[model samples]
Target: MFEPRLALASLSGEADAEWARAGADWAGAAVLGGVCLDRSTREAARAMVADRDRSEFLPDDPITFVDDQLAALSGVDLRPGINVRSTTAEPVREVAAVAADHDAFVEINAHCRQDELCAAGAGESLLREPERLEALVAAAATGADVSVKVRTELDGVDLVAVARRVEAAGADAMHVDAMDSEARVADVADATDLFLIANNGVRGRESVREYLEYGADAVSVGRPSDDPAVLDRVGDAVAEWFAEEQSPREVEP
Candidate 1:
């Protein structure tokens, strides 16, 4: 029903059907699951079927995997966002089409720091390779809204430049995980017009409001969102804040 001023960032295997359903009404937008299209997810899925110990946090169905979750979200009028990992533009349009079909948002997984993902030239590896990220965002359908998730403070990476590049490459929004320096969110927002979701270490509504004040369009809770109560508190806080900001003011005659 809304564009998710209060949101839940992607949390691999933990973010799924039951979790999505539990926080359905609380999170204006919820990333259904993490879908990685790379050597890592491929290995994980294969290992999953072989009963081996692996990440076990990947999309098996890839294309239609989140359809059920998206359907459940649609039942509640919540917007669905799918966080995905890939090393190439080969599947960007296909994935974008799936998200567009459901009116959901396709978020590029440039935030993951897994070793295997980086080895495969996906995830944070994209931070070092801006050209590839540009190709992926460019491959997204023109009308499909795309979000690029990236980590800040990586060695040798110009985060501000990365944000500007993604925005220029057609990413409508950015999910910024300011691992150690939360100021990077505002820095990026101040430097560009990209709608930003301030992420990392967000504990409550106060942090949410802080990020919003710093220029984020929204704030996202990841690990803490596993508990439904957190979403409840943040949702309630956002409602109160929204009212205050929208309330009428007396004219200064």
Candidate 2:
């Protein structure tokens, strides 16, 4: 499968046309528009369980805003947010509709470390709730393409089991937050056939190659986005690696 050499970091409430255009021009790959859903707040969390209008809850509707932003950002498509904290079948359907309307993809967020999410059963906390995770995946899949971005659960949870469930749910891909360890990443890749995108503390080209060698289909670097110089360095490293991989091998005489 083809893997993205570079994917713009999730912008979160920054899904404006300018941000999208900047991301498209700079990254030249998929752009995950920051975050859309807000289940972090106490009131928002309560409203979700009660099935109320959480649309006006967040600073802005990233799903609705992304449609216009994506029009400006030609090369990159949208990856709308579905934070596990407040996500329900209803809002998820709306997010999916926005994605479809703009020809974008849906990304289920299970990696955020926000305290509110942990308190309200969202983000990494949801990883412990396999049944709920399954339901979330099934709901998110109602869009064009569904991809779940999650953190590695090394405690007692079985990564393989989760990966299988995700794949079985017909998710397009799985983004694993491999953190800083290569060994942990290898273990996650051993568990599933779905395309794996590695994240967490990846800073340079060498690190990117290390993850790929560990069986990652793609590597996501976040810190580089804030610094143009770092971004350029990473971009160059990726280009060099790809060029070398495509270079002709010398024939033995």
Candidate 3:
């Protein structure tokens, strides 16, 4: 439903305001957080953000801190679309509402694989239970567009089936963190017509086109985006792609 030809996938706590200012100008959309849904998970979120030595130093208001974290980052001048990732336990309408209030898209995180997240039944743990996941998506009460970020290769979980249920629940996009199952993009693409965001190991413009050719509506870059040059390559690729799309096709003489 969104036109972000290239999206910055949720980078957990690594997506600070400084990172936002530098990267926001290039990517089509910028995703902030993997910001946790509740208290226990918020601790987990902070731990994940801090280095091993400074893990216990967070002394701020959690609700305002987390919401404002993304809100402040959204202040970036050039990022066209802003999205926030949250890991929740039950009804997610509240989280979605926060996103709506912030004028941002809300994404359900089913991709983070931390031990604490799984133990708490958040993150990739949701992949093991499709009904619960679908319920969370269906319970969203806001007008903000919802995106479900999924790791398609989770053992025993049918990626296509999950995508179908997400679509049935009226989600706006499916962010597929294809991992090594990049080929499965076609399967997910076939299963739903929702805006598909292909993620993981996107190195260059050709890789972007590869996923698009495989049926993804957008390509998301994660680690490589830490480097500005990589971001430039991604932007150039998208520009060239649009150029090609708008150009007249050749006719055989």
Which one wins on TM-score? 1
Residue 191, candidate 2: C-alpha displacement in angstroms: 2.6
For model 2 the local lDDT of residue 46 reads 48
Instruction: Write model 2 residue lDDT over 177-214, tens digit each, in one string.
Output: 77555666677678777777777766777777787778
Tens digits of per-residue lDDT, candidate 3, 1-253, equal 4444777765655654466566776776667665555666666656655644322213255345445655776556533233333345342566566667766676777787777667767788887887877776776634568788888777799888888887898788889888888889999888788888899878788788888778888888887767888888887887787788889999999
149 Cα displacement, candidate 2 (Å):
1.2
Candidate 2 has which clashing residue pairs, if any?
11-34, 12-34, 12-35
lDDT of 3: 0.70
lDDT of 1: 0.76
Clashing pairs in 1: none
lDDT of 1 at 134: 88
Displacement of residue 215 (Cα, Å) in model 1 is: 0.8
* True-structure Cα RMSD, model 2: 4.9
lDDT of each: 0.76, 0.61, 0.70
Ranking by lDDT: 1, 3, 2
lDDT of 2: 0.61
* Winner on lDDT (1 vs 3): 1
